[model samples]
Target: MTTDLLSLKARWADLRQQQPQSRIRDAAQQLGVSEAELLVTGLGETVTRLTGDFRELLKQVTSLGYVMALTRNDVLVHERKGVYEKVSFSNHVGLVLGPDIDLRLFMNRWQWGFAVQENGRKSLQFFDPQGQAVHKMYLTDRSDEIAYNRLVTRFQDSQQSTELAILPAAAKEIEKDDTDIDVSGFRHGWLDMKDTHEFFSLLRQYGVGRQQGLRLAPEGHAQLLSMEVLKRIFAEAADRQVSIMVFVSNPGCIQIHTGPVHKLATMGPWFNVLDPTFNLHLNETRVDQVWLTRKPTTDGIVTGLELFDKDGQNVALIFGERKPGKPELTSWRTLVDDITAAAIS
Candidate 1:
C-alpha cells in the first residue's frame, strides 16, 4: 500500500501539470482509488505524524533561512541567523532561543500555522490553552523592536476577546518584573561609590575615561557587572576622594559606545535615580542631563572626580561631591558619602 501511494504521489508531477487545481479527492474519483488512499498518498505518513514532520520541516526551513514551526504542543521559529524562538502552545512554558542557535522541538494540543511578510518580517500566531491568541508576534530586523511589537500586538488582539485568559496578564507582569529587577540592581550599584581614584583608575584601565562616555553593544545590556568589581571601586573611592557621591537613576538596560570610538557592549543596571520613568534617549541632551545632575557634587572642594569604571573583573562607579562649608551641608554630605562608600565597597 505504501509503495503504491509513493508511486502515485511521485506521478503527481505529471498529473498536477495536467490538472493544476485538481484536488486529491477528484483525482481519486477519476482513478477509481479510494479517497482515503488518495489523501494518504498526497500527504504521506508525515502528515499523519504532524508534530514530527513539522519539526523535521523546521530543521530544513531554518537551514535555508528563517522558519516558523507550529504543532499541537508548541511553536518553534527561527531567523536566517540561526536563532530559534520557542513559545508554548500550552500554558506551561515560553522561551526565546539562540545566542547560539539550536534546533528546538516541543508539543501542543492543536496544529499551528506560520506566515511571513514581504519585508522579511516573520509572524508567529498561536492560541493559548484557553484558545486565545496569546502569542502573536512579529520578528523584525531589530530584537527590541520585534519584542515590543509582539507584546503590543498580542495585547491589543487579546483585548477584545470575550474569553479572558491569564497568559496575557502573566506576560505583562513578567515584563514589568524584569524592568524592576534591572532598575533595582542598578540602584544598588550606583549607591555604592567609595574609592574615587581606584574607580577612575579602573575605568581608565578599561578604556572608559572620565569625561568621556562609552556606548555598549545592543545585546550587552543584559550582561551584569560583577559584584566583586563593584566592591573594589567603592573601596578605592572611599580612600582618595574627599566626598564620593554616586547618582544612579533611570536604571534600565543600554548598549553603549565609549569615547570617540564606537566600541559596543550591552551593560546596565542603568540609573535614572532622580526619575523612575526616564528613558535614555541616545543624544547629547541626555548626556548633558546626566552631567548637569552630577557636576555640582564634583566641582571645587572635591579634588578628584571619576564616574563609571570597570576593571577586568568588575565595574566601578565613582564621582565626587562638593565639600560643604556650612555644618548642615557638611553633615548631610558626610552621611551621603558614607552611604555611597559603604554600599560599593
Candidate 2:
C-alpha cells in the first residue's frame, strides 16, 4: 500500500472504532472521500477489482439466480429482490425488464466494477468515473455461489492496486436566471408535449431548470406541495389500494417499482415501504421541495408528485401506474386532488 492509502486506512480504522455501525458510504462522506476510494483500501483482501465490458458482465448476472438489486440517490433507496432476466443493451443504454428486477441502465456512465465480500455476504458493485456508487447487486442465500465465483475469476483485474484513481468532482453548472428564460414559449411547448419524456427536451430548449420550469408552468399545471402532505399521499395511496410507480435514480441508473405500496412506517428520519418484493426508504427530513406536476400525454394529462432535496436534486417521483395506451387512474387522480385540496385548506 502507498503511504497515502496507509494513512487513510489508519484514519478509517479509528473512525470505525468510534462508530462501528457507520455504513461505508456514510463513512466515506464523513471522511471527505468517495465511497470507491475508501473501498479500494481493501483491494487484495475483500474487494476484487474487475475490468471488462460491464454490459457483458451484467448479461451474465442471470446465472447467479436470485439476488437483491439496490440503487439510490442522496435521499431515496430503491431495493428489489428477484432474478436478473431479459437484459439488453443498445449502444449507451441498457434495460433489465424482468418481472421483478426492473432497471434502466445508462451504460456510458458506468466506469468501474468490484466484487465485494463483507461479513460473509457478497455483492457486485458498480460506480461512476467519480467513484460514486451507481448500482449494486447483493447475492442472496438462494444465489449460486459457484456462479459468483466463476464470474469473479473471469473478470478480475490483473493489478490489484490498493489506491484508486479518484477523479476530481465536476463543478456544478450555473443555470440561467429566470428572467432570461422564455417562460411563455416553454409553457407552450410543455402544453404541446405528447409524452412525459419530452419534458427534458423542453427544459433544454428553454434553458430552464426543472424546478424553474415548474415555477413557470402554465396556470394550474404545477402546485407547490407542503412537506407534511408527503406522508398523507402515501397513506391515501395505501388506503385506496392504488397502484403507483415510484422512481428513484442516480446519474447512471433508474430503478422503478410499479405496484401498490403497503406497510408504511417511519423510524427517525426515514419513511419506509416494507413490502415483500419491493422496498423504499426515503429520508424525509432531507427533502426541501415538493411539487404536484401535470403534463399532457396522448393518453391524457399525466400527473406526478415530485420531491427534491435542498440542493435542487430530485429525490423521487411518484406517479399513478398506467401503460402507454391507458389513461391515468381515476382513483389516483382523486386521491392526489383530495390531498392537494386538504393541504390547501
Q: Estimate each model's TM-score.
A: 0.21, 0.97
In the range 61-136, model 2's lDDT, one tens digit per residue, is 9999999999998898899999999999999899999878889999877988999999999999999988999999
**Global lDDT of model 1:** 0.31
The TM-score of candidate 2 is 0.97
Compute the lDDT of residue 254 as modeled in candidate 2.
92
Q: Which ten residues in a row have the lowest lDDT in candidate 1?
A: 252-261
Model 1 alpha-carbon miss at residue 2, Å? 43
C-alpha RMSD of each candidate structure in angstroms: 22.5, 1.2
What C-alpha lDDT, on a 0 to 100 scale, does residue 178 get in candidate 2?
85
Clash counts per candidate, in order, are: 40, 0
